[model samples]
Structures are given as C-alpha cells and as structure tokens.
Target: MRVALKYICEDVDRHGNVRCYVRAPGKRKVRIRALPGTPEFMEEYQAAIATAAEAPLRQADEAKRGSFRHLCIRYYSSAIYKALDGSTRNWLRRALDEIAQEHGAKQVATMQARHVRRLRDAKAEMPAAANQRLKALRALFSWAIEAEETKVNPTIGVKKLRYQSNGHHTWTNEEIQQFCERHTLGTKARLAFDLLRYTTGRREDAPRLGRQHMRDGRVRFRQAKNEHRNPIDIDIPLHPALGESIAAAKVGANLTFLLTEFGKPFTANGFGNKFKDWCRQAGLPHCSAHGVRKATSTALAEAGATPHEIGAITGHTSLKEIERYTKAARRGELASQGMSKLIGKTTA
Candidate 1:
C-alpha cells in the first residue's frame, strides 16, 4: 500500500524492498527504519519534522555583484572575520546583517561617510548601540579596502556619540552581605557570587570555570574576550571564601563548576540571566555579576594593591582600565595618606 505522509518518502530497492525515510527541508533525511504505518515510523517522522522546524531558515538568494550585501558576504568569509572570537563574530554579523538588510541592493562603492553617520544617528537614543553600529561598519569597510573590494571607507571620520555614565554598578558591602544571607553557602547562587567576587572574572568567563582551572593553589584560565586574537591567561591564588563555597556546593565531576538545571554547561548569556534571577530573589535587584568584579577591584585597591596588582587579578592589560575600576578607592586612599603626612602621623 502506498502511504501519503508529510515529509515521508519511499524508494524501492533492486531487491523489491522499499526503504522509508523522513526528508524535511533544511534538515538531513533520516531513515525511518520501520515499516510504513507503524508507530516507530510515525515517531521518527515526527522527530525529523521537529528538527527541520528548529533549523535556521534558508537565507535569501545572493545579492547582485558589487552590492552592499555582496560586500558583506565577502567580508563574512574573509580570514579576518573568521579569526575573530566567536562572540565578536556573532555581534559583528548581526550588526552588518541589519545594515545589509536595509541597504543590500545599493552599490558598495557609492556608500559615503554621510550614510554611515545617518546609520549612527538613527539610534541616537541609545548612544552605545549607535557607536556599535558605526564600529561594525568601520571594520567591514576597512576589510573591504584591504581586500580591494572598495576604495573608500564611508565610516571614516564618523565620531561616536559622547555620553557620560559609569558602567556596571559596583556592589556595596551591604548588598554583598544581603545576597550572601539570602543564598547561603552550598548553593549555586552563593557559589556564583563567590566566583565573581573572589576571581574577578567577567560574566562571560564565569561559566567556563571548573576544577580543571584549579592548579597549584591558583585558578588559571584564559579570558574569553579576544581569546583568539590576544589571549590573556589569568593565574591567581584562590581565595579562601571562594574555596569554601566551592567545597560546600559539592560540585560533581562536571567539566564546568556551574551547570543549569538540565545538567548542561551554561552559555554566557544564560549564566548572566540566571545570576540576575538569583540577585532578584535575594532582594538585590540592582546587583549583577559584573558588579561583583568591580567590587573586587575596589576592595583590592582599598587594601593597598597597586594598579598592576589589580590588573593581574582582573586580567586587565591597561593600567587606565584598572584605574577606572579603582578610581573612588584610590581617591580615598590618597586622601588618607595626604592627611597622615600633614599630621606627622605617617610613621604610625
């Protein structure tokens, strides 16, 4: 009997036997391995259909030659783009894709600095996002120039919007205590807190931590940002507080210390969202994982650690970045020292 089912196909072999398979768009064909009309056949067919549903949609046809889309497509396949870190590639692709979607039909050689400024000014409400778009366009055109795809860089001379604001909020001692009281030791929340607080790792680096990183009483791991281009290997002594939390949590033989409820290692974004939920539950809605890192830097500076010393722990290559993190603490420390010198109490 001939059966009619969606995504199901049958081919007769030379031996007069028919093989059934589930052939879905954008997905590999899976052999049903069961006779048609059986439960097994339907089960496998359903699974293949689901897989196809989850597969990314096929992209539109390639743009005409010398179009903006064509240029972006070439840039995407270039060695320069491929060499970028995974996160960087993803973000850059997203930014460029948005531009290509809007202006893909335009000639790449005709783009001017005014067009770049227009794109940047469109997101004027969000200065950071505007700057990011400009930054992505600059990189794309720069590569195109190097590859001889185009002679002009439209992004040239486009200034990023200036906005004054402190970055992530630095967690206060009281906020830390509140979170600690809410999420006691032996809990994942507390473990996450200690990891960021004591290790000075960014949110992106936290999910990568595991027992493998522990060696010679120090935690050693490469920072995730710009890892492929300029890897920064951090090797710092483990703090007793973090060690206590890790021990209390009783992390099993997982490759990573932090795991989702499904027992899989967390993606960076996933970990950050989960950490945010943990903070909310602790009644510290404003506290974040990065705030802990800032707090660590401030604490270290207040404890008389030099900028270089803070840089060593935080994996910061620039002294200016370390200074920004410890700015308030440094001011307080200098004030105290200045007063001491004036009062002749420097010896004490």
Candidate 2:
C-alpha cells in the first residue's frame, strides 16, 4: 500500500513495536499504534497515513503563555484562597494586585531576578513595608511553583530588608501613675489601657475580654495572634486601679466589658489610636498596645517568674522569644540589685 507521508508522526519502540500517531484532516488530535513484525500492523499504519494526507501542516507553538498577573490570580484563587485566613488573604490580594498594575503584563516564566530586585529596591527605604511586599511576592511565587506555573522562584534567594525596631515602649512606674491620674474612669480608652496593662494580651484580644473571661480571681482568654487556647492565670491579683476601672464601666446584659464610644465593639486599631492620644495627654512616650504585653512579661520575669511560667501567660510556644523578654527583665532587675548594694554600703 502506498502510505502518504503528509499526516502522521511515527516512532518505533525498543522492543520493535511500531507506534503511530494519527494526524488526520480536520482532527485536532489523533492516536494510532501497531504490533511488531506483522503485515497487518504495517497495513493499518499505511491506512492511517493515507487518512491524514490532506491534514494541515502542524507547527509546534510555545507553551500557552502565562503572565505574572495571570499566574498570580491562579495562585491566589487556587491554593492561597484555601490556605490563608480572610484578613491575610485580602491583604495579599490587594498588595499583589497593586504590584501587577505597576509592573505591566509580563509573562511569569519570563520574570527575572532583576524585576524582583527593582521592586525590592524601590521599597528599600521602608523596611517593614518592603518586608510585607516581599512576603506577598514570595507566597505568590511559591504557589506558582506548586501549580507548575514556573520552574524557578525568583524570590528564592532574595532577602528581606531589615530596619531598626524601636523596642517595646513600656511605661515606667511614674509614667503609669501619671497617666492614670490624668485619665478619668468609665471611658473605653481608660478601661482599655487598664485592662491591657493588667492582662498583657494582644490588642485584638484585649477588647474581647469580658466579665465572662474573669473567673476565680484571674483573667482568661485565648490569644488571637496565635490561636493559643491556653488560659493566662495571673496569681499576682488584679491591681486596685484596674479592678475599680472595670467596676465603674457600664456593662449591659448583652455587651462585654469594653466597648467603643458608640457602644460597639472596639477595634484594635481604634483602641490603639485612642491609647496613643491618652499617652500624649498624660505626657508619656508613644507606646503601642503590644507594649502592654511586653511590659507584663517584663514584670513577671522581674518578679522571679520562670521562662516556662512566662510562656504560659504570654502564649509563647518556644523559649526563644520568652527568653529575650526575660533577659531584658533580668537586666533591669540586676540594675536594681546593684543600686541596692551601693545603698547598703553607704548605710553600713
């Protein structure tokens, strides 16, 4: 039989089996195969060749080109959607969308280290901002690699920019006393600070503490930042200032202890801003809500609390973070001890 060469691609297996792929006219795809050393096999193969004779010539096209924007969308929609929480997912989506808009439509496969470096350089002035941007990019690229969108992640070797961290601005004893004197009770801002200093919880978790959380002479609530459900049992007892402040605040049957000026739940950001205002009014240094947590940890360590004990209260999973806080606290304690020794020598 005369076999037309126009339509199929052929390959012979190592075991002498001949395999034929059909490329017939008007067919988008085709498959054909034949047994080894058989006349019938050759006959069928020739028939397939003849059937594909009038088919259009096929040329290999580049893999379906995908842009950075396209791959990012796929990454976010697929893996990131399921993996991240609502707040984090929303932040990543917004940040990446903005980045894509700025960088134009470039193929993901073609994105180079240089492009990422340029973006990193532009954000170098703001380390925290740059770090967040890098994190989002890293997550996107990681997703892209998992989805087979790219073979290499340009963000692999990139390092996050570092900036000086203004350590926790915990209020001094005098500062705390002064702040309490200037601020009146019954206000959300005042109650918020008192509770924060007393409980040592994250800003988000502070407002969630209600009368229900207080039991058996201890404040207990799950940490929000880490979803750690362990209760913080403070044995030192709540200070009179905090106890009186909570008692003076209006508590509705359905409402929690802390509420906004309008009686709604207090958001972390809103409470932080108000706390800063209170600090300014009391002539104190600007301190974040997190500072309260640090201060509490410091105070606990200075009072001879063990690392394990401090971890229980702070919800620290590892001793490393707890150690850092305790180390600072210990340093302060040593300073006090040194002063006491000097005073004793003079008296003697």
Candidate 3:
C-alpha cells in the first residue's frame, strides 16, 4: 500500500509486521502504531506534524543564546509547560509562538515589566486577546525564573486589561425554540444542541461523552479542564429532551453519541468548529455551544435555583463562578417577586 502523507514512512518487517513512523527533518522519528487512515492514526499523525513543524524554528532559536525565542525554546521543553492540559497548552503555545515570531531576537534579560506592559497595551483594542497574551507571557517568564533561565520575572507587575464583557452570549429561550424549530428532532444538529443544552458540559467535555458515562438515568464525568489539579466530578440527571434527541438520531456501535462525518469521535476544537457550522445553517450566527451552557444556568437561576444548586448542573467549583452565570437572572427573579408582594400590600 502507498501512503501519500508528507514525512510518513512505513516499513514491513521480516515477519510481515507493518511499522509506521513520522520521520520529519530535525526531529526524532516518532512511531505511529495505529493503522494508517484510522481516526487514531490521523490524530497521532496530526500531533506529530505539529511537533515536527516546530523543529525548524527550534533549530534557529538554538543559535541565538539568551534571546526571547531561545527562552521560549527552553520554556517549551520545561516541565511546567508540559504539565498543562492539552487545550490550555495549545492556547498558550499559539500566543507565545506569535510573540516569539515578532520579537524572537530580543534578549530575555532586557524584558522589564514596562516592556511587557507595552506589549499588553499594544493589543488593547482586543482586551480579551491582550489579557490572554499577558497571561501566556506571565507563565513563560514565571517558568523561566524557576528554571534559572532568567533572573527576574518581567511580568510580575503587569496586569491584565479590564473590559466590560458578558463573555459568551447566552442563548435566549426564543432563540432555543428557533433553533429547535429549524433542526427538528432526528437531525445531528438537534442532538448536538440537546447535548449542549441539557448536559451543560463544556465543549471539550462533549467529545469525551458516551454511553459509558450514562447510568441509571444520569450522566457522570470529570471535567476536562484542570482535571489534574482540581478535578470536579459532575453527575446530572438526563433531561427528557436530550434522551429523546439521542434516540431519534442515528447511533451506531461507536462509544460517543456525536461522531464526525467520517464515523470517528471529534477532538474538542474540531467539534466546536463543526457546531459553529451547524448553528450557521440554522441561521444562528451568534449562538454557540458554550452559550447553551450559559442558557441552562440562566434558566435554573430564573426558576429560583440557588447558586449552589446551579453549580451542581454546571460543575462549577466555586460560588463566584456560578454567580457570574446566574446573577442577572437571579436579580430579575427577585425583583419580580418583590414587586408582586408590594402590589398586594398596596391593594390590602
């Protein structure tokens, strides 16, 4: 069999066992055990491609001692960065890589808090992005200080930009109805929507969910985020709507309720992008999977559920996090009840 993917090499051993490896330049050959073209194989292949893609830049950074890129190269190899979760590591890597590309040649020792502040301010137009960049820089510099790669942490005094934002837009009741009316019960879009709405799981958690997580009319799983540091286990009773959607949609022997068009499970980022396309097709350009989670919290809050009660469904670890989700709804519900009592007092 012929393989067309770049840098992929396959060998047949004397006993006729097929061995595959990704042999990219400047990096050690990584063995890929899964059969070619399978979902597992492609996942491993894509990861190898990403690591190999960094080889060229890493090689260049090695020659420039004490430079920012050199520091980044060291940071990437550090245990601190490796300890992060996959999605977090990817997010931080993209931010740091962009910074290194622009200012790779600068000396690490010269990066003061002022310099870091300037970088933060330069991206002020996008406050969230600016804050994210600042956060990535702080982590990099903190790691460098601990490793003795640098003396001082330049991001010590730097603060993230303040912005008034409600974060992801929560889907309204009307919007939910609109989406349901458009997608119907048996469609993949509806199942995806139902999972988001009823389970209230994060986008990353959705891909990992399957029949294995369901038992006795409840779904239980640990959140993907910070599972290593502070694991939060959530067990939510299955919603009738979600159960109906699952039965209506096509379910094969696959472990997950949602699978790619290729009949394989989705990566977190991949599913999010696919969900966006589904939303667009339903004429919901602004609504998203995260928004549905927020909507679930809002519904519970408006129904007079306490913050702790809401946290049970959302798997929020702190009262503060749940409050952020339910504050508006709670206030409105309280005001409505107060006004109804005041009207009764006046009539009496």
**Per-candidate alpha-carbon RMSD to the true structure:** 9.1, 20.8, 3.7
lDDT of 2: 0.67
* Highest-TM-score candidate: 3
Candidate order, lDDT descending: 3, 1, 2
Report the lDDT tens digits of candidate 2 across residue range 151-254: 97898788888678856687667766787788778866678887888777777677667776766776766655523233344333556777888887666653
How many Å off is the CA of 188 in candidate 2?
Answer: 1.9
**Per-prediction TM-score:** 0.80, 0.69, 0.87
Write one digit per residue (lDDT tens) for candidate 1, span 98-155. 8776787789788888999999999999999999999999899889999999898888
- Number of colliding residue pairs in model 3: 0
Candidate 3 lDDT over 1-348, as tens digits, reads 544888998889999999999999878999998766444576577777888886467566668999999988888788878677667878898898888888998898888899899888889999999999999998898888878898978898788888899888999989889888989999988888888888898887887677777789998988878875678898989888878888898676566788888666787789899988988887899988899999988888888889988888888878997886577877776798889989857753
Q: After best superposition, candidate 2 residue 77: deviation in angstroms? A: 2.7
In candidate 3, list every pair of residues with a backbone clash.
Answer: none
Task: Name the lDDT of candidate 1.
Answer: 0.83
Residue 66 deviation, candidate 2, in Å?
A: 2.4
Give the worst 10-residue stretch by lDDT in candidate 2: 55-64
Once all C-alphas are superposed, what RMSD does model 2 give against the true structure? 20.8
